[model samples]
Target chain A: MSGFFKSSIGRKYAMALSAFFLMFFLLQHFAINILSVFSPDAFNEASHFMGTFWAVQYVLQPVLIFGVMYHFIMGFILEIKNRNARVAKYAKNNGAANSSWMSRNMIYSGLAILAFLVLHFIDFWLPEISTKYIQGDMSGLLADSEGFRYYEELTHKFVNPLRVGAYVIAFVFLSLHLTHGFSSAFQSSGVSSMRKEKLQIFGKVYAIAIPLGFIAIALFHHFNH
Target chain B: MNLTLKIWRQIDANDKGKMVDYKVTEISEHMSFLEMMDVLNEQLVNTGEEPVAFDHDCREGICGMCSMYINGEAHGPDRGVTTCQLHMRMFKDGDTITIEPFRAKAFPVIKDLVVDRSAFDRIQHAGGYISVNTSGNTQDANATLISKHAADEAMDAATCIGCGACVASCKNASAMLFVGAKVSQYALLPQGQVEAADRVKNMVAQMDLEGFGNCTNTGACEIECPKGISLENIARMNRELLKANV
Candidate 1:
C-alpha cells in the first residue's frame, strides 16, 4: 500500500476512487433536491423516506462522511507530499510565474468549497436531523398546515431574498469548483483516452448544468413567490 | 532599436538579487532576444562594468538552456519560441524590459538570470530511460513497427527540450507538463511500453520529490510552452498512473 501510494498510478487511483464517491453523492443529492422544483409532494415524501431509512442514517451516512473526510485529508496530504518532494531535488530558476490563476489557487478553491459545505450542513442538514431524530420535535411550523414539511420549508427559505441569494452564491462557487475539479478528477483517475476530450466537454457541461439547475430552482421559487 | 533593460543581478546563489538598469543604443531588429542581450553585454564590457549574466547556448532555441522571465513572461511575451529565438522586432524602441530569473523553490538562482535546472536531470535519471544497453550490434532500426499516428505523437512529445519553461510558466511552478511530455513520449512508443508503468510512477514520484507543484490543468503551461507541448500529455500521464496504480 505504501509503495502504491508512492507510485503515480497509486495516487491517481486513490484520487479517482474518492472522486467517484463524491460525484455519486452529488448526483444523488441533486436528484433529490431537483424533485422539489416539480412536485413538493414528491420531495417531501422522499425526504421523509430518507429520514426514516435506518440503513442510510446508520450505515451509508457514516460511509459518506468517511468519504468526505478522507477525500479532504488525502488530497492535502498528497499535495504537500508532492510539493516537499519537488523542493528537495531541484534548485533551478525556470519561469513559472505566467501560469493560470486556477492552477495556483486550487487549494484555496477547495477550502472555499469545504467551508460552503459546513455552512450548508448547518443551514439544512443540522436542522433536519436535529429536529427529526434528536429532539423528535416533528412539531409546530416544522410540518406545514397540510402536514407537508420539507417542501414548505424549502419554499419558505426561497421566498426570502437573502436566503435565495446565498443559495445562488453557493451554486456559483460550486460551479467554479467543478470547473477545475471535473477535468482534474479524470486526470487523477487516469482516464484520459480519446474519450478524454469527450469527458472534458461533458465535465464542463455538467459543471455548468448542475449549478444552473440549482440556480433555476432557486430563482423560480424566488420569482414565483 | 534602443532598449532599456532592467536585469536581475546576483553574484551567487546565496546573494540577494536586484534589477539593475542598463541601456543599449544600437540593436538590430533581426537579433533574437538573447542576441539583443549580447549587444547590451558588449556595451557593459566597453564601459568596464560587469556583463549581465544569462543562460543561452543554442540561440536556435533547441538546447533548452535559455530560460528568462522577461516582462512577467516565461520566455518574454512570445508564444512557442524560446528567448533565444525571440527577435528584437517584438519590442519597440525605448522599451524598459524587466528581466528576472525563473523563481521556484525547486529552481534556485545561479547568477543573474541563470538557474540550476539539474533537478530535471535528476528526475529524468530516476526513470526517464529505457534499460536496454547500447551494444555495438543491436537490432535493426525498423525492428519496431510503430503506427504512424503513435510515431507522430511520440515525436511531438519528444520535442520537449527540458528548458524548464513549463515550470517557469506555471503558477505553482508545477513540472507536470514537462514530466508529462517525457512520460507520454515513452508510453506511446512500443520500445517504451515494457517499463511504461514503472517509468511514469518513477518519473512522477521524482517530479514531486523534487518540490514541483501539482498540476491544476490551468492550460497556461500549454500556451507558454516554447515547444507547444499539449496538456493532453499530462492527461495521458495521469491515465497511465491510474492504471499502474490499479
Candidate 2:
C-alpha cells in the first residue's frame, strides 16, 4: 500500500477511483435535484422517500459520506504532493504558459467547488435533514406533515432573485471545474484510449448541460414567481 | 545588424540569477542564433569580460544540445526549428532578446544559458531500453516487415532528440511529451514489445521520480516542440500505462 501510494500508477489509480466515487454522487444528486423542475411536490416525494429509507439512511449514507471525505482528502493530498515535486524539479520560469489553463488552476477550482458544497449543504441538506426530519420543525418551508420540505425550500430559495442568482453562479463555477476535472478524472483513472475521446466529448457535454439545466430551473422559478 | 541581449547570469546553482544586458553590433543575418551568440562571446572575450556560456553541439538541431529560452520561447520564435536552426534574420537590428537556460528542478542551471539535463538521461536509464541481447547481428534487416504506416509513425515518435524543450515549454514543467515520445517509439515496434509493459511502468515511474509534473494535454508542448512531436504520443503512453497496470 505504501509503495502503491508512492508510485505514479498508484497516484493515477487513486485519482480515478476517487473521481468515480464523486461522480456517482453527482449523478444521484442531479437526479434528485432535477425533480424540482417537474413539480415541487415531486421533489418533496423524492426527499421523503430518501428520508424514510432506513437502509439508505443508516448504511448507504455513512458509506457515501465516507466516500466523499476520502475522495476529497486523497485528491487534495495527491495534488499537493504532485505540486511539491514539480516545484522542486523546475526552479525557473520558462515553462509557465504552455499547459492547459484548467490544469494549472485545479486546486483553486477545487477549493471553489468545496466552498460551494458547504453553502449547498447549508441551503438544502441541513434544512431537509436537520430542520424537518431531526428537529421536526414544521414551519413555512417545512410545513409538510410527511417530514419532507426540500421542494418548498428549493422553490422558495429559487423564487428569491439573490438566492437563485447565487445558485446560478455556483453552477457556473461547477461547470468550469468539471470542464477539466471530467477529462482529467478519466486520464488519472488510467482510462485513456479512443474510449476516452468519446468520453471526453460526453464529459464536456455533460459538464455544460447539467449545470445549464440547474441554472435554467433557478431562472424559471425566479421569473415565474 | 546590432542587437541587445538580456542574458541571465548566475554564478552557480546556489546563486540567484538576474538578466544582465549586453550589446552586440555587426551581426550577419545568415548566422544561426548560436553563431550570433558566438560573435557576442568573441566580442566579450576581446573586451576582457566573461563570455555568455550556453550549450551547443553539431549546431544542426539533431544533437538536441542547443537549449535556450529566447524571448519567452523555447528555441526562439521559429516554429519546428531548434535554436541552432534559428537564424539572426528572425530578429531585427534593435531586438532586445532575453536568453535563458531551461528552468526545472530536474534541470539545474550550470552557468549563463547552460543547464544539466542529466535527469532525462537518468529517466531513460531507468527503463527506456529493450533488454534484447545482440548476437553479432544474426537477424536480417528485412526479416521483420513493419507496415509502412507503423514504420513512419514509429520514426516520427523516434524523432524526439531529448532536448528538454517539452519541459521548457510546459506550464508545469511536465516532461510528458519527451517521455511519451520515448515510450511510443518503443511501444509501436515489435522489437520493443517484449519489454513494453516494464518499459512504460519503469519510465513513467522514473519520470515521476525525477519530479516532472503531470501531462495536461494542453497541446502547447506539441506547438513549441522543434520536431512537431504530437500530443498523441502522450495519449499513446497513457494507453500503454493503463494496459501495463491492468
Candidate 3:
C-alpha cells in the first residue's frame, strides 16, 4: 500500500497503464506514417511540428521513452516471477485447453517487439535527432523550405527490401502481442462489464488492424517508387 | 472397464516424484474418480505394493480436500467439480489417466497426490476474516441495509472453497483469482466495509508474500474455477487495492 506501484497487482496496473499509453503513441505514429503516403506536404508539416515543437520533443518524447522502458521492465519482472511460481512444472501439461495461444506466449512476442523497436529507433527516431540536433547538419532536410527530409528518409529506408521485410515481421509480432495485451491491459486495471466484452472484441480488431495496417503501409512504400 | 492409470508418486517433499503406472480391471463406470483409486489401492495392498496416497474428504467436492491435477486439468476434465466428484464414466475403457498433485512453489508436494496448501491458510489468516462482536450488546444483523446486487455479488464471491484449482490451472501458478474472491466477498458487503481498505491491502500483500505469481490476466483461473468465479472479482480487487492505496 505504501509503494503502490511496487505491489504485484499495482505493478500490473502500472504495466497496463503504460501499455495503454504506448498504444496511444502507436496510433499517433501510424497517423503520421500514413500521412506520408497521402500527402508528403502534410506529413512534412506534421513531422516539422513533431520534431521542432518543444513540448513534443522535450516533454512528450522523454515521457514516451520512459513509458516504453517501464513496460519492458515490468514485462520481464512479471515473467521472472511467473517462472519461479511453478518450480515443479507438469511433464505433460496442456495449455491450449482453456487459454488462447497468444495469451500464453506474451514473453516471446514482447521480445520480438523489443528487437524490432531497436531497429525502428535506428531507422527513424535516432537519425532524426542525431542529424539535426547533435551533428548540427541541416543539409537537404529543409529543401526549398517546402519539403522535409523526414518524408525522404522514410522513403529512403523503405526502398530497401531487407528493412521492409523486418518491418513486416515485426508488425506480425506486434499484432500477436496486442492480441492478448490489449484486452488484458483493461482487465489488469479493473476495466470490465459489457464494456469489457466490447473491449475484448475491439481488442481483437485492433490487434489485427493496427499492426496489419503498419505492415500494409510498409509494403506500400516498399514495392512502389 | 479396465483402465490404465499413471499416478505421480513421491516419498516426501525432498524426494523427486515420477509417474508410476497401474491398471485396474472391472472398473464400474459409475464409480467416482477416488472410488476407482480405492480399487487400485486394494489391488496394491493385496500384492504387498505401496499404495498411492491422494487427498480426499467429503468426496462430493464440497470440502475442497481433493487436489488432483488429473489428465492436465485441475479437477479432471469436468468443469465446476473437484476430482473426488469426477466419475469414472468420464473415461473410456483402456484409457490412460495421468494424475498428479497441484504444483507450485508455495504448494509443495506432501505425498503422491497431496500438496501442502496451507499457504492459502496463511494468506487467509493474513486478512480473510471480519471482526465480529461476540458480546451480548452486538447490533442486529438487519440494522444495516445492503443493496441486493451487492449482497448477491458478495455471496457469489464467498463460494470459493479454497480449492487452489486456480493456482493449478494458471501457467504462472498465480493466485490472483483466489485472493480476488476473498477480497471481493468482503468488499461487497456492509459487515466487511469497516475494514475494507486494510483487507484489500493486507490480503494482497500476503498473497505476494506467499510467492504467488502476478496475474497477467490469462484468465484460465476463471475458466477452470469450480464455482465459476468471475475474472471481474480480480478486477474488483485491483480497483479496491488502488482505491485503498490512494
Model 1: lDDT of residue B230 = 86
Error of 2 at B11 (Å): 1.8
Query: Alpha-carbon interface RMSD of model 1?
Result: 5.3
CAPRI quality band, candidate 2: acceptable
A138-189 per-residue lDDT for model 2 (tens digits) = 4424453654566666667776677777778878877887888888777655
lDDT of 3 by residue, A40-78 (tens): 889888888888888998999999999999999889989
- How many collisions per candidate? 23, 5, 0
**Models ranked on TM-score:** 3, 1, 2
**Residue A130 in model 1: lDDT:** 87
TM-score of 3: 0.97
Better of 1 and 2 by lDDT: 1
Each candidate: what lDDT? 0.79, 0.78, 0.89
Residues B132-217, model 1: lDDT tens digits: 76787777869889999999999999999999988876655779889989999999998898999889888888887778776656
Q: Report DockQ per prediction, comma-separated.
A: 0.37, 0.32, 0.77
Model 2, residue B56: C-alpha shift (Å): 0.9
True contacts kept of each: 0.40, 0.33, 0.75
What's the lDDT for residue A10 in model 2? 61
**Could you arrange the candidates by lDDT from highest to lowest?**
3, 1, 2
* C-alpha positional error of residue A186 in candidate 3 after TM-score superposition, expressed in Å: 1.0
